[model samples]
Target: MAEKKWMPRWFYQLASPRWCYQITGKLLPIFAVAALILLVGGTAWALIYAPADYQQGNSFRIIYIHVPSAILAQSCYMMMAVAGAIGLIWKMKVADMVAKACAPIGASIAILALATGAIWGKPTWGAWWVWDARLTSMLILLFLYLGVIALNSAIESEQTAAQATAVLALVGLVNIPIIKYSVDWWNTLHQPATFTLTERPAMAMEMWLPLLVMVIGFYCFFAVVMMLRLRNEIIQRERRSSWVRELISG
Candidate 1:
């Protein structure tokens, strides 16, 4: 009789860098395809099918992009911080790499959110920029991401760099809740959330369904990009290893 295994074999296999590279390579194409299809389909549905907002008019359509990018930006930062914590706690090199990869991606997404918010604001609020609480907190979030990246790059020692960045990432997490609750805690120009966990979406289903698709597609795209960056990082860091040499030769 075969002995029962205490944990799934793949769980252990994931600890191997080579195995991770191979598995992520296989998974990337699937995520890439899904992201492309969903993004394209969602964009079409949003632009062509969804009706313009009665109050904000067509300018409100930017929400499809703005909201998803903002959501992803915050989520990516949380992921980075969590990965950094794991790396600091367990000394996991892969977790450190994941944390490093997340910084620039999160920063870029945050910028997208800020840009789209600005554009949406011009038509709605009649201003190019405002020092609203939500906006200011989001700007701080972007700076935190940049700080992590800059700190990691400034340090010469890889281990020290990872540890330093991990501390910074963990510290930045306090701002996330502030960003989320800024509108509620303070009188702000930005509107309340369109979707909420405790209540139905304020927008009609026709308006929100496309936004949902865009949000999912954005997440899928983030996964695809993060995995791509991780694979590159693994290759660069593991270049001296035999498996990487074999992969390069093959």
Candidate 2:
């Protein structure tokens, strides 16, 4: 099947900064509009229409944002790590662009997760913070993300910064697995997945379905935000190139 493909050998041309810029520019506004519609719609649906939880009451509504953001936080870290690995392996310039673009978004999501977790905990666990494995690991994940961003910006040379961040990203990968298992491996104040459909969703469809919409909206926002930042990175990095000159003029 791989051999039968009619695509060009240089299909990865999409990774080129200019190519990505041109292409993403065309669709970015669409993504932005979609993001606005979905996020606003989803938030309204979750907060206003969803049924209150039997156990936690309206407080469970926080999960509409928290759980999805937390999941995206972890997954985005993985995406950044993979981007770093690509830079390390193939020396692709855009990989570092993606990694650089990803750092702040990942950090913000981590903060949202931590903040919402604290909010949820106050009512559910009667405390705002705990040193449980999941909580601690998530904090460490936030720190690791900060380290990656710091190390990159701390360096003066672009190549040097990319290389440094790539190494840190690779080394920090140990935390993802730890964070994933923390909830299952040890008892914690945080609850496990509540909206699973194949297994069992803890809440009724009235609650989970809207939460799912919010989760998807969050993901769309993430993509739009990341790509918007990535475009800036590409411009900054490729300013000396001819394509950038045309981009600036055209």
Candidate 3:
């Protein structure tokens, strides 16, 4: 009799492209609906109900968009790098696909954060752009994302591309902490983190709640987008597989 090796079932399932595709198909609607509801409710609450900053006034509302996007950008990059690492270590095609999907979405989110930051800064800092530590690190993050995308595209072989991008993503992981702590490490104009796990928020509940909603909404939105992209990547890469052929024919 063969001895059984114990491992988490879901972890094994994640290695299956078919399972991933089907599971994400089931999950996509749930995330899409949640993202829609939370984003809409959160945006409305931030704009109408949340009290304005006494100093910044209505302009502070931009944080509702800017903060969530900024957080998501960093989070997505982390996910991408980790997924790439998994693909490299385990040779899981689904993980490689997930890493590839994360690049474009993260790059877009990074761009949004940068744009909103610039818009907010014009009013607060009396300048459209400044070479602040946090902002500079974030810009570097965008470049890292672009580099992964470009490197993957440049390679003709899929496996080679995945390997190359994974290495780049892993190398870029060093920047994540730098971006997070840039405000503390340097005397930049960028403000300190608004939300922290260790401390209470400095803002009122009315103001904090909507921001929280927006952050959750953004994460839901990211999940939906990532799953959609992942499914496509799976289908594209698995097109020759029997199950995929059956799925397509059906």
Evaluated with TM-score, which candidate comes out highest? 3
List ranges where model 2 is wrong by over 4 Å.
1-11
Q: How many clashes (backbone N, Cα, C below 3 Å) per candidate?
A: 0, 0, 0
List the pairs of residues colliding in candidate 3. Answer: none
In terms of lDDT, the poorest run of 10 residues in model 2 is: 3-12
Ten residues in a row with the worst lDDT in model 1?
Answer: 1-10
| Most lDDT-accurate candidate | 3
Order of the predicted models by lDDT, top scorer first: 3, 1, 2
For model 2, residues 55-142, the per-residue Cα lDDT tens digits are 8888978888888888899889999999988887878898889998999999999999999989988898999998989889999989
Give me the displacement of residue 199 in model 2, in angstroms. Answer: 3.1
Local accuracy by lDDT, each model: 0.92, 0.85, 0.93
- Compared with the true structure, the alpha-carbon lDDT of candidate 2 equals 0.85
- The lDDT of model 1 is 0.92
- Which runs of model 1 end up more than 4 angstroms from their true locations? 1-12
Q: For every model shown, what is its TM-score relative to the native structure?
A: 0.95, 0.93, 0.97
lDDT (tens digit, per residue) of candidate 1 on 1-250? 1333634464356556788899899999999999999999999999999999999999999999999999999999999999999889877788889999999999999999999999999999999899999999999999999999999889998889999999999999999999899999999999998755478899989999999999999999999999999999999999999999998999
Between candidates 1 and 2, name the one with more favorable lDDT.
Answer: 1
Model 2: per-residue Cα lDDT at residue 45: 91
